[model samples]
Target: MGKVWCVGISPTDPRLVGIEGVTFHSTVNGCDTLLVATNKNGLGGISALEDNVLIMHESLATATAKGLHRMVVLGDTSSLEGRRWKVHAESWDSTMGVSVNSIHGMGQLIVEVLARSAALKGMQVILIRVGLATERNINRHLARAFTHSSVRLESFKDSKIPDLDAWTAMCLDESGEFNSEISSEQWAPSRED
Candidate 1:
């Protein structure tokens, strides 16, 4: 089975902060350490590095086959204020009815897409820094669907510092599954198919 690291990012300003808010567990050194940001900007500040940037819309299976071990998820939590966060939370609860709903929804979608591309490859899907907004706002039905799937769901504590380089290194060392022999292929689905 392959490993997948789902890094969560606040939609603040990638320029201002790197990937700070993302979360995931480290499998290296046989220790389970949660990687989180120390600042609000999170890892968004260091997105220029190829290893640190991840397009959420991309298919997970294709990325995994191509040796993509780290995923940076840009969520909508950074844009909310105290009041707005509360409102969003209430709305999400009304919609999904649980905090893990959004994370589950994302996990299921990622798993389905990646599974189709790689024939349902075994993979671990880690949800990083899934705090307040999206945490409370996800659709429960979608989340429940994912919980019954095969993807692994792991969460980390929020960090105050947004360090992209450190997080990238951690992901590569921990969740990276492919070796040098693996080849990178385009995983986009064709409309005609």
Candidate 2:
């Protein structure tokens, strides 16, 4: 089975680890929201969040080049003017409490970068929005941001927030390579807290 990466705020959701093809990766660390502004010159904020997103894009791109064919992103979504979408990242500094950063051109940048990678074609990318009681429209708007990209996009709003097993099942089912034998407990935490 191809390697699958679980990325986002809590990418290492315990349920997702130990699965045969799943691995956890974090792009940001205590920030509650990762807001991607709609316009190029939208409200400007700190570069820390934007930098983290770029790093994420780079990591995924490199992994794609290395034959990673599946990805599951866990986060909440938000949109501006009903056009652009944003994702949550880990806190840049846990000591500072939760922070909010407004990044312009995030949607376009995500698409443009990922779409440029020939290795990402046919990749199964799943965006699992983790909040339940919030609005769902933003999720769709966020999902649409990648509509024209090379990768196959699937977005779901999980109110109850599923575990690693459910996420792995979704990725494997999408990739048509589910293996029932691999136990979720077989994998250990790879990142330090």
Candidate 3:
């Protein structure tokens, strides 16, 4: 409901351009919520550690400094491995297809770190994974990493996806809630079997 901004990417289309007074910025300055998109430099193996870490680190720090608590990240939050797509909820089910190459994006790390920071700051974050069979390993890691109450994960099922208008509308909707098939505490490592 407050001033929502899109970070990392800009809104060129009219639909995503005008949503509840949403604005675009390179930083998370003066915003109540942020919609962050992944950057190109973050798509790599361990060799791209610096790029992956720095982007998320800078974004989180800026958001914290700006008093921003909520964020919706659109990226490759899942580790597709060989699978085409996946849905994270009470459990990791509803998966199909296979990928040509692996897609382990930096989004998982970004979201995980942000979620932890949010947990500490009493904030909330949602990760909306885009694309199919993009990155399965990271997806698996993310499903298990979202143990904190401050974090939630979801994904788009179709190929030509990310209905920006719908997503932004939901992001701005006060009562809007994202679906996490599995509960965060369900897979907590600390939980005794």
Candidate 4:
């Protein structure tokens, strides 16, 4: 099958590794994100995506609010490799503390995990942060993807968390040839203390 890919840039960790085909370029996003491929064609017409590509999940970029939202799915780059997106939601617990909701919120911690996934498990984790015109636009799409049934909530240790405040919101990370999917479901807030 043909391969579709994300064509963007990142100063923190820029470089599409492992993927069989990919042409590079630059962008202005300062944060890590898990971008749902609404359209590989929308990927800005890179040479790699000019051929056979598999359509995974909804694209947060191209998909219309009425369109992609209907599907209620953001992205699903899952593949044979262990690279996968364990979708989860955000929640707070008395004993465990605050649980991170999305991988995007994980930031560099997510990057560390993806690197480990590729090296140790031999799989890639798809990452994307919506770099639209404004934060409002980005949050709109995130808000939709966040609540999708696919996403769920889980627990994480404080040691692994780089900065809970860093993720005052949600986002995504990783790219290249790897299996990554969106984590959705409990995108709501908890009144618990």
Model 4, span 1-193: residue lDDT tens: 1122232222122223332222222321321223323222323323224321222222223323222221111222211122232233132112222233333223223333332233233221222332222434333444433332222222211234332111212233223222112222223333430
lDDT of 2 by residue, 34-129 (tens): 222212323356453454456457656565555544443433322111221213322111112212233433443353334334223654443333
| Model 1: per-residue Cα lDDT over 22-78, one tens digit each | 323332222122111212332232332222223333334334545544333332222
Find the 10 residues in a row with the least total lDDT in model 2.
Answer: 168-177
Q: Which stretches of candidate 3 lie over 4 Å from their true place?
A: 13-15, 42-49, 77-91, 94-103, 132-193
Among the numbered candidates, top TM-score falls to 3
In model 4, which regions exceed 4 Å deviation?
1-28, 38-73, 76-141, 144-153, 156-185
Cα deviation in Å at residue 164, candidate 2? 23
For lDDT, candidate 1 versus 4, the one ahead is 4
* TM-scores for all predictions: 0.23, 0.36, 0.49, 0.21
10 residues in a row with least lDDT, candidate 1:
178-187
Highest lDDT among the candidates is held by which one? 3
Worst 10 residues of 3 by lDDT: 165-174
Model 3, residue 111: C-alpha shift (Å): 3.7
Q: What lDDT does candidate 1 reach at residue 63? A: 48
State model 4's lDDT. Answer: 0.27
What is candidate 3's CA lDDT for residue 172?
17
Per-residue accuracy of model 3 over 1-193 as CA lDDT, tens digit each = 3445665556443324333324555545567776565655644665444554555667767777788766666554233333343343222222322222333433444444564456445655655544332244333323332332232222322233332211211111111122233333433444221
